[model samples]
Target: MTEVAKPGVLPARPHFSSGPCAKPPGYDPAKLATDVLGRSHRSKLGKARLQYSIDLMRELLNLPDTHRIGIVPGSDTGAFEMAMWTMLGARPVTTLAWESFGEGWVTDAAKQLKLDPTVIKADYGQLPDLTTVDWSNDVLFTWNGTTSGVRVPNGDWIPADREGLSFADSTSAVFAYDLPWDKIDVATFSWQKVLGGEGGHGVLILGPRAVERLETYTPAWPLPKVFRLVSKGKLAEGVFKGETINTPSMLAVEDAIFALEWGKSIGGAAGLQARSDANAAALNRIVEARSWLGHLAIDEASRSKTSVCLTVEGADEALIKKIASLLEAEHAAYDIAGYRDAPAGLRIWCGATVDVADIEALGPWLDWAYASAKVAA
Candidate 1:
């Protein structure tokens, strides 16, 4: 295949951004406008689509009846902040910082809320030692670190029964990995990651315990209308029923509905999991075949199946940049460079939207890029 030079143009397959990932194979944008556009979100049609999305997600994830899912404002970060600001302060909070996203939550607790927090910190590619923590405390963690491509192996490490709640930011982990709902109290995700939908909408799932906390304990800081989960000291029942706390983007909601429905049509969560697993396996094969490139994730078990982060072994920054530019100029990839804050390398989004065949095609290009790199180096 000829490599062409065009900024922002993606490979025929379009499989790379970490979030707002490539849309599902064969997605028809026109169908969205005809079916979802020109309709009021509060109308029966919109409500049905919204309600169906919630039901499908619950069924696919096997969520318990005791749990409630809400389509909320902002993306995963916004959903997480709503949970943190609304549910913390009544208890001692423990924040785990292993990657950039984890550090963000710690900052929210320390600087924004000014809550006295016990933070556990680990360098990139490592997990915070959970064994050292006190279990009788509310805890927060990011299940997958998109920037570092490191993930928590299991919720098995969390105490079986803690007096306080466990909150998770599963933006990059959902659908690609197993999340132990039993071990989590409040979990947040965005539509754009694994689902490959439009952004601006966040999903928040709260366990019964989380709801109890919301009703029984209000934060010391006043809540804004956008962040309000509890209205006048009462848990917002309507939010869980497709009634958003604020004006929501019906277009985004409709996109989420289509994505959720698409997820169901392809064998639901299992299909999404398999797609991610296959993409990751294909990348692993590439790493094994090529000596110059390898995963930045130290351990195979800890590596993310969704966002595959790889470092060009023994290559300098300039060489890595050259290879990345080569890939981009060819329109073979988009946003494949490693995150700015992380060490230089390539980060491939292997979420459900990415096909294994595309990864296979891209594998040789990695080798070609490296050969070009050796000449440049």
Candidate 2:
């Protein structure tokens, strides 16, 4: 490990890449390995660590007894696909796509499942009208659009007692915001987002309604071993326990446990929310002060506190990319560019791993980048 030193400089501000963010301040890689990685996941010690992880997650989220949490395959994407493949055929599907990842899932539903999907799309900065949705149909949506930095305000509009299931991809919103669980049947998130854990694994949570859907309705297509939610119409017990369906990266598990423990130490969800809130508030102040910078999300309430997307006034794609390139080269920021397929601008991940002080540092860098871009153009 290399040490960073400068006479007047504070410690390196946390890197704010959208995913796989910089580890928290004072993260000890060696300690995490020793504390979480010595045993096979199947051994008694492994099981105890896994159980502790689950219990801590439940306590942090205040989950109900009826809900079940599982460490599943792949990242959040894997957990989401499993739910879509297993529990989706009961009713007509209503999918929402406001950003890249949401659109990716919609594509999977169209191509992989070959299901006729009714996709509701919004431009990069906007959200689809919830009033326009049909509550009678099963719904799939990203509660927080990670790429676009927009989020659904609340689940309040999701008809209280709808007939169909609600599958939400809450990867970026889980710890940083209040998720009204009653409105969702299945929710998925990866530890890498807010938790700053290792990647390649996903946490899948199922509400009682989703479990019933799994038991009552099997898809017309054959299920693969990894995606299978049930054996003989009963949900797998190992899923909720430490027993994963396949071999998992024990190191990644340890990293997740470490992040979760850190979350608990900082006051759990409330602390995480404060971190995000402070970062967002700091960035919003910057955005408001600048004439050229404006948020991507149109509605104030729906704007995400985790990933804060900003756009330059009348800037073209090439200019936006140029500015992003400058920031990366300077090491003032990284992964702050907008998604390639979306309208171009700056995108900042303001999750819990990111510090308010780091975001404050970013404001001047952004102003400098914007001015340089305008001059070059």
C-alpha RMSD by candidate, in order:
3.2, 4.1
In order of appearance, the predictions have TM-scores of: 0.93, 0.94
Pairs of residues at least 3 apart in sequence or in different chains that clash in candidate 1: none
Q: Pick the TM-score winner.
A: 2
> Which lDDT tens digits does candidate 1 get at residues 266-320?
9988988998998899888888887767788888777889877888777566776
TM-score of 1: 0.93
lDDT string, candidate 2, 186-266, tens digits: 999998888888889988999999999888887999888889879888988888987888878888877887888888889
Top-lDDT candidate index = 2
Q: Mark the regions of model 2 whose C-alpha exceeds 4 Å error after superposition.
A: 1-11, 33-38
Candidate 1: worst-modelled 10 consecutive residues by lDDT: 1-10
The clash tally of candidate 2 reads: 0
Q: Which regions in candidate 1 have their CA more than 4 angstroms from the true location?
A: 1-12, 33-36, 315-317
Clashing pairs in 2: none
